[model samples]
Target: MASHIVQNPSAGCIVKFMQGNEPQIAWVMEEQKGKLRLFLPNRRETTLSPSRILPWAGPSYPATQSKDAVVELLNRHRERRERLASEVAPMELWEMAQGEMERAPAEWFAELGYTSPDADAVAACGRALLQCKTHFRFQPPEFEIYDAATVESRRQAEEAARVREAMVCGGADWFRRLWEARIGRHPAPDASTAPEEPVRGRLEKMLRARMRDPETVEDEALWKQVTKGLPDDPHLALLLAMTWGLVPEHYNFWLDRADYESGTAWEEPLESETQELIRAVEEGGSLPPAEDTVFISIDSATTRDIDDAFCIASAADGGWDVEVALACPAWFWNFDSALGKAVFHRATSIYLPEGNCHMMPEALGEGAFSLFEGQARPALVVGAHVAPDGTLGEGSFRFSTIKVAKNLNYPDCEAALDGVENAASPFVESLRLAAAMSDRRLASRVEHGAVIIERPEIDFELEGEGADITVKLRPYPAAPRAQLLVAELMVVANAVLAEWAVKNDVPLLFRTQDVAVPREYAGVWKSAPDIARVVRILVAASLDVVPRPHAGMGLSAYSPVTSPLRRFTDLVNEAQLLSVLTRGSVRWSREELSDMLMHLSIRLEAAGQVQRFRPRYWKYLYIQQQARAHGDECCWKAEVAEENDMWVSVSLPEVQLGLRGKRSLFGEKVFPGQELHVRLGKVNPLRNEAVILDVREC
Candidate 1:
């Protein structure tokens, strides 16, 4: 059928055929039906079909001609055709024939370039068209011309392909050399060994981007091609980025993973809002009324965003009237504005060993909205009368401008409670009253099935920056004196405010823990073993628009409206409460608030991961440093929380770290509440792994 379709060449006729990418000249020595016996240029004989012949064929030769003569003729023809192909400018020919016709034979193109073109001229035209793929597409008998737009696009793509090929050949090897140089596997490479200009810059950018977010990398196919021969390591991009000096050692990739922006750069777009807030704070007198409550705030010494404060006074019925003043950015914050959206994306402030990532701009959170001592600031103040029996009476919520009388740190307050003169001495009597009320409240909550764990805070101090950084972990007071007062009063304010919301039927994001706990699990727990035992059976709190009982707090309902400057949920709740107090209606309906919370839940989960893991990352780094400095001689105190045949879970109360090891390392009688000292081995901070080398019972 192919013989019927294709015309067979006569014997001894020189023809052109394709051998891979190059064209070859061959003489037909014999013909049989569709088959032809041909002699190649190298004096080799082969049989081929007539359909295999290229479009162009040459003049015939004598069958009895010498082999040398035929070979010489073939070489001469090959040289002539190649030279003609070189002389034909593909672009010039494309310009000449582009608008002339949609498609044309090679002979026609040769005729357009020459008067009465020969077979060599036609074949050269075909060869040139095949080589110039951007302007023309070859299809056997004819070549198709591309339009101007398509030709330009294809030309650019062809150029990019060439560059990519060049990068893969040279850039990959260059990166390998740099990586080897970084690890001391090879000598450092010189500047001359780097890839040229655009490739070097582009490669560095790509590596950085991949290191930031590896899963969503652009040009992933090209990345695979370029990194084909590199080690199949998950942290390859990070390693390469470090080697290229794009990032420093121990870079925070978790921030990149969550797409959480660091620093005040995110506050640039809200400059106008920030300035407006500052002006509002400076102007003063825009609130509902001014309160003469002389509230005092108790927080860590490093705290700048003072959101909540409280003051106590004796009521007529021998009860303490407690008033709480919370920083109110809700009065000026526009929830529909860009700043609000950014704040919502952050969800909550993250306190890490490195620094605090505030939810709101510092201009507003720390300066304007914070309840700074002696400064008149807008506040959402809640007042409730706590009876001598610790029963809370009717509460009131109002928007007021208040000034904090003192800003006391925990240690100074504790010393003041012990009758040591300090800045907190003026409030010593009031602190005693608050502590007495805290004791009664703790007794009342425990009677109602509350489980309170008073865990000491671990202060992480960093001495340096980057790779040479050192960390020191110091445990704050285990049985806190002043912290208990602040915690109980804050919990009372939230519970009363939540109760008020229920009566008013206003929607707030209430924290609900609707689980039943055994009455035996109710008292305060201070030891690590005691805290861990009670915590194992407890469920985490959940958020909802409807009011429900919070089992852990032992309250009828609880809503977080204390930290408006640090948490988005508290700001929203404050806004709702302010609206109900002013206009007698809620700002957001139940359904609308629920829908908004769905989006916030995702961001909160991401923020929680960063908050929960980033500090542990630093703690692991500290442990590794300690292990290296003292080897097996360094020991850490651990309390066994759980034990099984396979593994033992222990809690290190000093650093607030938890670890698990094989049961065999803890001897035959490892049980809960058992104290031991462990030596860490095989510590890898990046992977969050620290193995226990040896353990000894204390």
Candidate 2:
């Protein structure tokens, strides 16, 4: 009895017809050459033979003869999957099935290439083969046997893929909409549902109080008191802001807006400078006289448009002579033209994901009035020379039409310095000497006190297969070698400009950066860098040499003149330079320049919003993959890469494993990061989610 009950080594089967139950597919596994054999469950079993299993039963099959009319059918089918699944199989099962099919190959003549079936025909045949074990199927007489099933399966698979892609696409759209709606730039579905309330509290009063004061023109009396007949311009304001000086955005907002409006006044407050601006540009377009003086660097190897140039030569009494020239374009695109109005509405150029947004059309921006090519253009030049050690010497401003050799980007010049050739220009040599002198001067100012910070500049990759954004840090070797050279001239020029303004009492923009206040970051202060350190951060950004520290660079004083291609304030600085040198006057009022400072500050802040979102989302996806690929088998270890008020950063040691291309799931699994794990845990690649199970301190 024990021997008989030993659970027959195999389920020896006999076919029986059942009344209700669906036909059970059982493979007829029999002992053959001491190994198990599997026969097709779809056909009937008969006399056993070494060959001639499935006969050429299909009408489409080749005309071949076989010894047996009957074939073996599987007794108890192990399992069955979807037709498409079986046909496509997984990538791993090709050898076994193909091996079987190759031997005594199917008794059918597969069609030749000259007359080919369409994709649908191929898919239908493939499905039929999976369902009918012998790769033979009963097709409607209306269709070819192979063509029908092959075509059908393919259609089904395609439809499934289409659905999957739609699901993914729809889901992404939903989330993006949700995020945008929350930010309030646009209203969402529920946005308008709120009941309209009666005019209630004084909303305007509060809003007005919060908004910065507007003005038409800068206060002339106040400005002249400060500038002293020199120019008060945009560069000065930007530098002042950099040095922690406060400038409100609303101050300049209304002034720019006034140009497009008619003599009819909008409710917005604007300074007196705004009136000057509207009158100046209300004509066809702003264009200065071409025959006028131009700024040039005639020796650059590969550039067009000489926007600005500087000159440094030995002065009498063993002093140095220096001069800085800047391009001007506001004279062209006046307030009346549609193009100019569009630029005014945009407020300034926009840097975005797809491409750049220029405030002014290229017709003016890179053309006509542009400091492009060998064409002599108008310019406001500021020339100054310090002693051999950078002590402020003789300085003056003038109008000039200088020529430029060629254009060079930052990298081009850096390369030249590294011996890449053609980057250096004879015209730029004098500036280098001036830069050395300026560096020495600024060094001394730092000794007095100024702030300096080293931040990793950021950039991004717009397109790649992944959903998340990634950025590669540009190497420092890319920093332009001409930086200090040009900077010295600009700074001295700016210093002279500012000093002239103060002495002559003119209104102009002044840049400033504030020291970090302890109360603002008190939450973080409670844990990390105490109040003292925070103060250090502020001080490090504020040491000014000529009282205009622009301390963020740890300089007593500094000014920006490079890359006017993108900055509006720099152009404004050029405007101030023009007023001072050419007219011996000041144009924009302190209120107007101050107002622009406010607008730019806001613009800078808004740009940051777009940048931060992409990277954070990408990081989330990467972490999901990290958790999925590694299980809770061991407590994972990682190093601290960053830490802040809310979270600590970590870096894991190397381990070899596939991260399963983003958001793909394998067997059922849990997500990672569910818990604050010092340990290993579950990961879900499908949804880019993670759950931390256990954590071990690293």
Candidate 3:
């Protein structure tokens, strides 16, 4: 290193010094043995070695000047320094912008040593400032520009700051005024005369802002300050509950979150298409003749998409001949049409607590293609021969038109089977045959090591709408005689179809679960914990183009060919089957099936999440409501389903409520299958959380 000694240096002299490799200008302030204290162009003071100093070559100024002239020169120099500082590095421009000095006028460039007539130099400096603005937040007025993202960020920050200020100084009224000002409106001079609409609008905006940027409004004190005096309003209270992270009064948010579009009049099948299809069916245009069989459908009373119906009769070879007729939506559905594509994206109908979203257009699903009583509809019929020993024999499928004799619901069928008053008049013989078939199928399934989980299903019905909503929970009646009949016959039909497809080497979607389940599992479970344990061990079923055994259903091969009106996969399968029957081969190849499944999986997963979560939300809401009605200290009888070191999962059988409780309350001895009485508390449906306040052995 060279000796850093400055000799004979005076104050107020412009000098150049080496800072790293580049030379920087400074004014000498004081001197020491080997170093000098100097002031940089930007007026920042620093100490440097004298060896780095050199006399400035271009300019010189006397140590003393007249006061007025000196002042003028200093101002000019300061302006030059500021411009230089801004140009020196990108960080300096950022600092200037952050300090609220975003622009510099053309006159400032002239003051910074550029002549007024040097248009190119002035333009160059402006260009430089414009380039810096790209990297910083500042811009010269001459080269001003705006970016949408940057503008949005600035607006959000400013709005957040304003909200904070309003919250700190004024309560709800002041914030409402500020919001009105932002939207270019003036508040009423008298508070009594203020329009309710504007107040509600302001409340909604604030709630949305709080939800969108929670970090800004996370302070509890600030929330209390801003929300003061607004809770009394019913609408504001509801919004506040949502903003405070509680479940909203209704489940409408799910529709928005899931992007579910409701059925509209315009969404119905085109009038021309409907009329043409109806005329075609009437004239028997390119369709198979009607079948001579008494067909009946079993479903919920509210069901509109009655897709599958069946009839059982004695065969010629001393066995049962079972005929199943599936509504033929595929005959009219155009696979390349926009409606078909929409149905593919939806994948399946969504059944909610309040209503359902159909997979097919209403006009077609419930009217044109529906297998209603006395209506002649086109269908795909599958005929299976059942041996006396409950073994399925030869099966064949065909396309035909069918007339359903009646559409019976499960309850009505059950009542008919039990020989109740008016119900016994219809479908009594069909119910008897269905019961015998179900019993045989159940025995077969049990012999094949299929585990039947008999957990009681709960039906949650919402009466009324919005804030006046009330949820009714009741047992859905698991495996009712009528339900069992429909389920067993549908399974047999699907299995026969799956086997036929595989034997013929046709590409079709097959539901598979190749995992090995316990071979001894059988029968309706008496304990919830036992059923839960068995369920935990079973692998989830998946769908593919290849045939594989479904261990849960106790089938060697299975595919869901029923419910074409409710599921797109079924519709696709129905279409393939129709093509095979009419054109002598399936329409889709393995690659095409795989491609369809790739998109189907994403949509199906999303729909499944909505189905799984939204129902639980409503169920928990019902539980909370019950607790509130009966008082928090009310106890419920629960059976322990599972337990760990810290928590115990309990099943409330009566209410069909499954929840967990801290193990500390019941002690370490708690185990599955143990019955206990527990009090419910801290029930929050929005968060899906609840705790057992107290517990004891029942």
Candidate 4:
């Protein structure tokens, strides 16, 4: 997390805090630690120690200025939300919501002018009530509160010091990872080829070898050539794995490839997590120690800062297997730890064009806790013995330390179709089969649809010095075991949570992106027929939930379970499941659950934007550098890959970019089918926006 914020451009001239914007404060009427505090934008450089705040800022000032201004903003917001919320119930149900917002520091409420805050409050409650106990609140303090001693210059000086000291990138190990991120070819270079291969004929020959066999070949020449080709960065492969699922963990397992390529692969501690796993295996015992509690597990995207394992079993009924997995973050860090929350906020792993930043540390991500191959690492398996048709068969959910026997990737699992050594074992094969069954279960729900988008990715060659990377699909992009295997397991587990909630009448987050209706989602799918079709298609995929099709994935009720590293929804999904299934937590009232869902849905959307736009801005920068010769107004031809009422996926192979539309560009209305010039214009440095202009006028 970058601690030093550049400036507060959005800062209003109200009150101040220690020479900065104490623009926002979080005050739950009950507990402070339970929730987070966002002080204007984000408290990036500020070491915000939450002080018990009593109504200090005084009554509302309206987040903006004029009564008319407040009325305009609040009224407009209310109108939009009321239309959406009308489907649920009468507006009278959310009385508690008004109270919660009122308690949010008088200044915060006042910022919105409180002209008719009750209405805004109602809308907020309705949205939250609808989604995953989630919703976004507009909190603008009427007047800023400040201690007012320090100057901006002094604050800047202090912030610089904090950033320099806090950033571990100041160290060599971290620096090396960042360096390779700029210019490294992902998957390690050594893993790309053998120990020796002529540089000239390398690309063509390796392409051929890959076609012959994607698995590791004991070729020394290829091994050496890989080291020569790849940059020494541990985080590069980690980054690729998180974003595109292109680089598999097979490329850098154990320490051989990691040490060879990252320059410190062999530097495992004798008393480290690796040693503990080996020791446990030697002793014929569970991973680490039965009583140690914290397990250090690692994957390509995650490092050794995890303390639990999870797997699946069948449910009690003669149906699909129920999934049971252990999450030890509760034992490792608290909600208040700045670092911990940052990781939690990320919700899932994000693979960057160059490197990856994991949600947790390396020790926890890949340690004694991780269910290692041929070793029974301690795990909290949520197993479901699902039937071939995705019905919940007999299942069990428990914590245990069991040997995983065979660790396999997608290709390996696929190869198991043929007789191959180390093919996906029966245990994995069952999970895959179970996932397929769950898909059928999901498919049975006719109202929702799942939108599957193949957003191509990139591998940058950044080694300290930034090299421009052309983002594209992996040359031979194929499905892998880990991808869908985890997906099905999570869906089933999420279903379990939903089932438990309903059985107990626990109110919980039920997520749904607003459908493409005429008034709502008008940004896309303008035509009534097109909008209705999109909604029908999406609603069909959003299964097992009350809402109809997602109108996106084509799944009536499609939810993501794979990456908890980058998405908050995944974290909430786990939390809900654990609370309901494991601890037998009480369900919130439907109203409460609805509120939570609104926030979760909104945050998930926000987090996705943050994850997407940040690196994408950087990628766009590199793209311009890569295709600088194409000039600005060439015929950047594109074929309509996918489209809805709101936007269309337009692919232009020339500059290698996809243009997303504010509204749908479906059917014959787009390029590739016709000649259209796309002007790759200016980019906003802060928003990270790459503006695309249609230049038929050219």
Report the C-alpha lDDT of model 4 over 582-693, residue by residue, as the tens digit.
Answer: 5677434456556555544444454445455545555565545544656653445554445556665555544345566544223345532333445555643223455555
**True lDDT of residue 152, candidate 1:** 97
lDDT of 3 by residue, 98-166 (tens): 335434443343335433413223333433443443433332223233344664676677666765664
Models, CA RMSD each: 3.7, 26.0, 10.2, 28.1
Best by TM-score: 1
Candidate 2, superposed: residue stretches over 4 Å from native = 1-307, 314-320, 333-341, 344-354, 393-395, 418-420, 423-435, 456-460, 464-477, 514-536, 539-549, 553-565, 580-585, 592-604, 607-698
> Candidate 2's residue-wise lDDT over 1-698, tens digit each?
00111112222432211123322222224546644343334554433332311221111211121212212222111222123224443112222333343322111211221134322223323333434432333332112233335546766666555544443343234323433443455644342331122211121221222222232143333323322333333233222221211223112212222222212132124323344443443342343433333233422333333355655666675656766666655433233444433443444444433234454444444544445546555555676657655566444655554444344555555555455655444334554455456666555444434333222233323444322333222223335336555555566776676566556665555454544333333222211123224445564331111235454433333434333433455555556656665577766766766665665556544433333332333334345444455644444443333333444433342221112212211112322322122443344322233443433432
Off by over 4 Å in 4: 1-348, 374-378, 385-396, 418-442, 445-464, 467-476, 480-482, 507-510, 514-606, 629-637, 641-649, 653-657, 660-698
lDDT at residue 282 of model 3 (Cα atoms): 64
Q: What would the TM-score be for candidate 3 when compared with the true structure?
A: 0.70
lDDT of 4 at 28: 17
Q: Enumerate clash totals for all models, in the order shown.
A: 0, 126, 0, 167
Question: Quick one: best lDDT, which candidate?
Answer: 1
Judged by lDDT against the true structure, how good is candidate 1? 0.84
TM per candidate comes to 0.91, 0.43, 0.70, 0.44
Could you tell which candidate, 3 or 4, scores higher by lDDT? Answer: 3
- Computed on alpha carbons, the lDDT of every model, listed in order, comes to 0.84, 0.39, 0.69, 0.39
lDDT string, candidate 1, 563-675, tens digits:
99998999999999888888888889999999998988888888887888788888898898888898779899999988889999898877788899999999998778889
